[model samples]
Every structure is written in C-alpha cells, then in structure tokens.
Target: MAQVDRQQWDVVVVGAGGAGLRAAIEARERGARTAVVCKSLFGKAHTVMAEGGIAASMGNVNGHDNWQVHFRDTMRGGKFLGQWRMAELHAREAPDRVWELETWGALFDRTPDGRISQRNFGGHEYPRLAHVGDRTGLELIRTLQQKATALQQEDFAAYGDHEARLKVFQECTVTRVLKDGGRVAGAFCYERESGRFFVLEAPAVVLATGGIGKSFKTTSNSWEYTGDGHALALLAGAPLLNMEFVQFHPTGMVWPPSVKGILVTESVRGDGGVLRNSDGRRFMFDYVPDVFKDKYAQTEDEADRWYEDPDGNRRPPELLPRDEVARAINAEVKAGRGSPHGGVFLDVSTRMSPERVKRRLPSMYHQFKELADVDITAEPMEVGPTCHYVMGGVAVDSETAAAEGVPGLFAAGEVAGGMHGSNRLGGNSLSDLLVFGRRAGLHAAALAAAPGPRPRVSPEQVDAAAAEALAPFHAREGAENPYTLHQELQSAMNDLVGIIRREDEMAEALRRLASLRERAARAGVEGHRQFNPGWHLALDLRNMLLVSECVARAALERTESRGGHTREDCPAMERAWRPVNLLCRPVEPPPADPAADRIRLERVRTEPIRPDLLALFEKEELVKYLAEEELPE
Candidate 1:
C-alpha cells in the first residue's frame, strides 16, 4: 500500500484558476483554514489563457446599459434555458465583482474620461465588457493571485504560519471526493512530482474546477480541463444539469496544423472584425436566425454604421451569439466557400488601422504573427469552429452554490451549471468565476463552522482509494495503451457529437463510449510512477470517459436545436423541450465493479420563471425564441 499523508482543514478548494483563487481568498479571510489543490502549478491555470474581457453591466460606456438589460441579454443568449435566479444574481453582482477587482489593483484600460472602459461583445446590447487590451483574463488571474497571496500574508501575521494553514497544493491531482456518512469529508489526491498520496480532510469542499472542453479533439482548453470537478461531484452523488450543451466558438485558428484549434479571441470581432468568404463577400448576413433577424443588420453599410451608432443601426450579424456564428462558419466551409485552410476569413484591417489593431489586440496580433507567420494587422486570418466550453455541470443552488444532491459540497465557475443555460456569452466566464466563487466560499466557510463533529476517514477507505490509483501499473499484459484510448475518445466526440449532431450518429457514439469504457478499464501503464505521463493519463481517462458518457447520453436525449445543442433531425427549437433539462447520474454496479458502472440520464422539468423577470422582456421578444412555462394549478 502507498503511504498516505493526512491533514485537516476547514475548507478545501479544488482547482487554482480564477474561481478557486477567489474562493480561497474569501474563505481564508473569513478565518477558515483553507487549502487549494490543483493539477498544475499555481498561476498557470487556463484562466490566464482567457484574452477577450470580463462581462459586467457597469454602464461605463453606454449610460442606458444596466443590470436589467444585461440580465435580459444573458437569458436570450442562453436560449432562455438559464436558471432565472442564477442569471439574475450573476448580472446583479458582476459589476461589483469587477469594481472590487479594480480596487484590488487590477489595471484595466480607461476611457477618455478616466473611468474603466467597457467594450462590445456578441449578444450584449451595449458595450459591457471591462477589458485590459486583449489580455483581460491574464489581469483577472494576476489580480486574484495577488489578493490570495496578500490574504496568506495576513494569516501569517495573525497565526504565525500560513504554509500549514492556508496552503496551496500545486501540481497535485484530486481523484475522488471522500465522504463520511453522506457528507463531504475531504478529498483524496496525489502529487504529480512524487506520485505520493495525500488525504485532505475538510468539513467543506468547493469545486471550482473549470469546464470539460478538453474532452474534444479540437479545443481551446488546456490539458488540465478534463472535467475533474464535474466527474467528482457526479461520483460523489450529485446530478449534472444540462449536459448536452457544449459551445464551439466561431473563430479558432485553422491554419498551421500545430496551432489548429487555438483560440482566436472574440475581441477581434468585438473590435470591428468581419467574416468573409474566398469570393470577397461578407457571409454573416445570410446566416441570421429568425430569433434575431430583425435585430441584426442585413447589409455591410448598416453593420459598419452600427459599430459607431448602434442605437440608430441594427447590430451586425457577425456579432450573433456564439452558437449561431459557429454554425454559419461550418456551413460556409461545407459549401466550398472556405479559405485554402478549410475555414473562412476573419479580417480586421478593412475597418481598423494597423496601429489600433495592434494596440487593442496585442496578444492576438502576436499569436498570429508567431504561430501562423501571418500579420493580422495587414491581412485576414483563417478561422473555424473549435470546442470551447461546456454549459453543463454539477447542479447547485442558485443562492448558496451548494451541490444539490450532496451535502457539504459546493460548486462555482464552469464546474457548476445553470448560470449560462444552453450557451454562454464570451466574457461571462471571468465574471462568473468572481461572482459565484465568492458565494461558494462564503457558504462553505459557514457550513464548516457549523456545530457538527469533524468527519473521519477509515483505513479501509484510504487503502481502497490508493489501490485504485495503482491498478493501471499492474494490469494484465497486452492491456490497451492509455494514449491510444484518449485519442479514440477525442476523435469520437469531435466527429459524432460535435457542433452539428444527428440522432443516428449520437446513438452510435453511445455504443462506442460503452466499448471505450470497457477498454479504458483494462488500459495499463509502464514505468515508475514518478512523472509518468502515461500513468497520469491512465487515471484521467476514468474521469474523461464518464464525462463523455454524460455528454453523449444527454445529446441523444435532447431533440431540439437551441443554443449549443443542435439536432439535425429536430432542426428547430421545440417549445415542448424548453421547460426541461437533462441531468446525468451514476448507476453503481451491483457487484462493486468499477468497470461495470454505468451513467444514467433523465430529463427534469424546470420551474416557471419569476413574474418580475417575465416583465423585463417584451412579448414579441419571446414569441418564438422563448415563452414562460405555464404554471400548474
């Protein structure tokens, strides 16, 4: 048996991204003995890779913009499938979160009048994103990290030791959420450097572990985004809501095979870029959906005027919600109007000067220059769809951010569902991490401080968890290779259950997933546990496969084409399907076989919207796109 190092804390936060760091700062400041565990080194999380901006209705640029309008746009962008309370709370609190970040020393771009400047993004009615050039996400993470570090220093001043109390376990991967008598007791994790096991016992566990984009072949998400928190919460007995909704961003780089699928920030379009075909004609006008047909401009001249005078001219079709734009790009590529690199052309030069393009989108300019050998300020770039984020995850309370079925377990950020509904707005993620992450931390600290005995883990449970971690190294000979299984899984998800979907293909995907699950169990690894990539992937596969099962199962069940989930058979959004959400649950095996465990899914109907929210929208706005569900007597 592997030696296990045991420790105790008031709260344990999983993941070290913007959400985790923000949660940790809140928990530690509230006097909880907090610890953060992550799969990568501190400050290297995917949060730092975000480049567009943070969404908030601060009303800095446009006086008419406020939380109500932000709330309405969010619900519309989500296809009205969003949880009313979460969306409401997010819009209401996001502005404060941004201002708080500024107070903590985040340097955002300022307007000519010296207020924090806001920029335009798709699905937003006005300029609503607070940015720092094209590196807004970087500033968010850097500022959050600084604040957390400052809190650790305060802990040191008061307690004389921060390392033993408020700590960060970097380069560590948590495999399971340990429970004691039906409540979250702690987490079981292993360090990547030494392959040593550790047991972190905390009364409360907050899962801030980002999204599931890494499950697909072409993704902007990094390796650590393999749905750890989503899988952990599910296995620990929490239902994942709306597992079918996965967003494919419209403009990932398509040329240079090595850099394919890397994110081309939405700031390009937000800063007046346009999409065109090889025939030198703008194509977004031909792809506007009925829900937004009257709102978007149909001609290039109108679109150009809308950038400067949005109230007078309609919004541009190029600025449609991500799902609509991604589908249009895919259709154009399939219709043989694509560039030589199997994509359409995204150009900013025709509208903005070279100096302004470089000044506004410095990272994007450098990214294209260094990776593709293309100068974006002077020319267009080849772009296509790439899997970006999952809008489904562990279902949590709208107010408390507590996992619905699991006690003492909280979730926030992309790991928790309902905030974004079916499709998320581009800049909403950073703001979400701040808004809900604080709530989860605040609630978790109070729960840990409540009158209850400290949870304990038995030796038998520790031994079992340790044994499971080591099984991949001792499997029978001729077992499958972890790398091969991973590639096959990614390929299946991309080809069968990608941006566009068909009933027959998704059903076949489930069969392949079942087979893949079986093969994954028998997959083995060689070499010592020290820094072995194969061993790491072997364990991560268990999580990736289960998450894939949830996604495929939900995709097969949802018939309507709405937001991120599109079904060719159904073709259009169905009113009947609008009021329900698909939830994924686990079916533990009767014989205690991990390999035989199956993921079961069912649709749970959503509650009717609040009367106040219904009043915010005009009747014409929801005539076909979304209508309030009828209340039962």
Candidate 2:
C-alpha cells in the first residue's frame, strides 16, 4: 500500500460551509495559520440553499422587537430544551452579525424607515428577521465568500505571514481526526482529485460540518449534509446531545418527484402565503395552542381582516410554527384533502401583489418556473414537510463551541449541539453559524497561541482510515449501490421516524437502521476516487448510519412528545419531561451483544431554570389570558 504524505498546520478546520468559512476567516484574523478542508467546492456548501432570512432583533420593522423578545422566543420555540446562555448570546449578537454582513456588501431588503427589513416568522413574537428579499442565504453566502476571498488576497499581500494566512483545500475529504494523548491533534484527509492522502497536524481542530438530514429519504438538506462532524466527534469520544430532535420544515415542494423535497422557504408564509387543503380551507386555526389562539385568526374573514390591519388584529394563518403547520398538513393529507402529489397548497397570490411577490421571493418564483413549470403568482404551490435541520449535534459549550469532554476539538454551526434544542425557529440557523463560528475560531486560535509542538500522525491509523475509504473501490461482490441504500435510509426515516412518531414505528426504524448499517459494511463502488459520486455516497453512508441510530435511539428513550420528537404513543408533553437530553457516544464493535449493540443512551444534566426565567413564562401566560379576554371579533 502506498503511504500518503503529511503536513503540519497551526489550525485545521473541517467542512467549509458557512460555519467553517467564518471560523477560518476569524482564525486568520487572529494571527493563526488556518487550513479549511471541504468535500465540495467552497461556494457550493449547503448554506447557499437557505432561502429564509437570518433572525436578528434589529427593531427595523417593529419597535416592539428586541433581543429580549428574540431570546424568549428562541427558548419557547425550542420548548426550553436549549441552553439559556447560548440562546441569550445568539439573540444579543445576531443583530450586530447581520449588520456586519451588510457592511461586507450584503444588500438586504429595506424597511419603510430605510433600515434592514424585518419580517414575521414562526415562533417569533414580532417581526425580527433581517432579510435580502427571499434569497437571504444566497446573499449571505455570496457576501461571506467575497469577504473570505478578500481576506485571502490580503493574506497573500502580507508576504507569507502565518498570522494572516488562510489555506483552503477544496474537495479534500477528512477521513478521521488524529488524537494525541486524549486531545485532538489534527485530521487525516484524502484529496479527491488526486486520490492522495495527507495529514494536517494542528493543536486545534474545528468541525463545522452541518447536519445529518441526508439520513432521511425525503429531506430539504443537500447531498453533502451527511452528519460528518457529528460522527467524527463521536468517534473522537465527544458526546452528542438531543440527537432525536430533528426539525422538518413545514413547506417543501412536493411535485416533480426529483425536486419533491426541496425547501419552499418559510419566507413564503412570512410574506402572507396561506396553507390550504383541496377544499381551499385553512387548517392551522384549529391546531394552534391557546398561547397563540388569540393571536391567530380562525375564519377567512378574520384572516383577511388581520391581513389588512396587521397590528390591529390577529396574525394571519400562515405564520404558525413549523410543528403546528406540519401536523396540520399531515391531517389534511390523511383526510383526503391533499393535492395530486399528496400535499396541501401554499397560496400567496391572494395576499401579496405579483410584483411584490416576484421581488421578495425571486428564488421561489425561479424554482417553480424552472423546475415545476408553475408560476407562484398565478397558482397555489403544492407543499409538505421535509426533514431540514438537526437540533441535535456534538455536545458543546455555548461560549467556546468546544466539544464537552474532548480537549482541542471544537464544533460550531449545525454540528455543535445545544443552541436550538428541541426545535429551531426559522432564520435562527444563519445567526447560529456566524455567532458560534466566530466563537469557535477565536477560541481555537487562543488555544493555539501557546504553540505546542505538532503531534505525530500515526501511519497505522492513516492506513486504516485510507483502507476503509478505498474499500468500496476494491469490492468484487455483487453491486451494492450506495444511492439505493441512501434512498432506503431516507425513506425509512421519513416514513417511520418523521414529523410524527410512535414507539412502535421508532423501534422499527432502529431495526431498519441496524440492517442498513450491516449492509453499508459491504457497500460497493464502481468508479475511481477522483470526484467519484459512489465513493462520496459510501463515505456519507457511515455518517448517516451513526446519526440515524442516534436519532432513533434517542426518540425511543424519550417517552413524551415535545417539540420535534412528537410521539403518538405518548401524545402529551409531560411536565416531568423537563428538557431531558440524550448523550450519544460511539461504542466500538466487539463480540456484539445484540442489546448493547443498540445506541447506548444516557441522560445528561440540565441546570434548573432560574426563578426570573420561570417568572417570565408566568408573565407570558398572564398576557395571553388578558389578550383572550380582550379578543377581537
């Protein structure tokens, strides 16, 4: 076997998505030589697909919106499972981050008062999302990409100064993290184009490798979101938290089978789109909780009235939380009120002007025009739930984004757990990437400032990883297609462990995942290593298996339905449930005990809510009561 060469670096960041790019930039600014490794092209990371705006309490559209409100909304939205400190930091810092993006040439929509526009979203009490029309993620990625490009230019101009350098290795897939005496040293990577292995030795390593949504068959997440960071951290002995709580976006395009699961941005609803059944009846009014009952209009007359007088009446039917909307759509489809593709309708034409719709939702219009041959301005779009984001990930501290129990290993963005908790509100993820990404970079750079000698990379470890990576190519057995297995995994997840779950279905999902894991061991590839889709899928399959097991096992352990882990068997949320977090650690394969082979689950400690925070919930209830009493007809 040919051995690959190795190199040393001050800091190595994996997964060049929004979080990785942001962290790399910050690390460079902090005077550390930083290298970014990604499996795909830099600009093509999954962050580009996020269409909804970034949530920030900018107080642009509504004076009532503020950081406190944003914080409270985030906590409630996550069902209080989120770390209060992280939520607090995210809420407070998000406004400045969004504004910082503006300074870097991001052109967001303007409010009537000429400030960055804020719009209403599910779980937010007031309009607080800072947006660039509808393709906010695109604008964000473009701006950040440009900024990183500029930084690279500046770094080159600095004449080989390590402090200002940022080295990006595109299409380089990290196979395993290298550890030194219980600390993360660096990682072993394989360059896709050259099919050559390399070692990056550093004092600090950051994993910003997004979510595990590819585990599910029908999802809004991109092909690259294979839960790499989650698996890597688990393999490196870091605990993963809340792995069961997966957020399914309420509206995804449900026609043209190829694009069936593409996310139909939440901004559609925020901009006055209404979800309806075949009979043209709005269904969300009947499903909302008492907290939002007074705030939501039931009748079409009331909805139209609320639309016309935004602040004078209740909120329109479209702005319900994702969970509520998903459940409503499920009921609608089950009751035989669905469209041809087994989805309900999202109609925006009734509420917004065609010109306004086109301007605010260019992507939505373009997607429909290019893919479905349907125009959003003329007809209702078929929509349903699609697995989008993971609320669970490698357990980490709110401040440092450093993985708990794992020294020298840090995580940020979708990979690091505990920010969103049980459910994430729309637009919060972008803010999460920026806030935690920067924190991880700063923290890692500070740790690197001591300049410990580079740890040695084990040739044996690299060889083992390389063998596993290349095993697919050498398989001579009957063709075992990775894509087919991936589809099966996704289907199983979507059907059994989806928006709603029951104990039996979750158990079945676990069984299916175990079978998939066994099959993945024999999975085959029929192509060379360079840009081989088969090889990529095979690598991603391992991640999907680990993540799926984590999610399924966590779901079965939690007896109550709360937020995204809705269990039909335990239909109601138990007060005793109280934000119980499941921590996952990978168990090495041995003389397999059938029972023990299952995901080993353990509950983690959660600090009691402060009296002041508990008081706020009480105050919110009182406000809800008063609003109910003063309800408008």
Per-residue error at 96 for model 2, in Å?
1.2
What is the Cα-based lDDT of residue 380 in candidate 1? Answer: 90
Candidate 2 runs further than 4 Å off: 160-164, 476-479, 588-598, 619-633
Q: For every model shown, what is its TM-score relative to the native structure? A: 0.98, 0.94
Model 1 stretches astray by more than 4 angstroms: 310-313, 590-597, 626-633
Model 2 earns a TM-score of 0.94
Candidate 1 clash pair list: none
Q: What is the alpha-carbon lDDT of model 1 when measured against the actual structure?
A: 0.89
How would you encode candidate 1's per-residue C-alpha lDDT over 136-167 as one tens digit per residue?
98999899888888877776787786355579
Model 1 vs. true fold: TM: 0.98
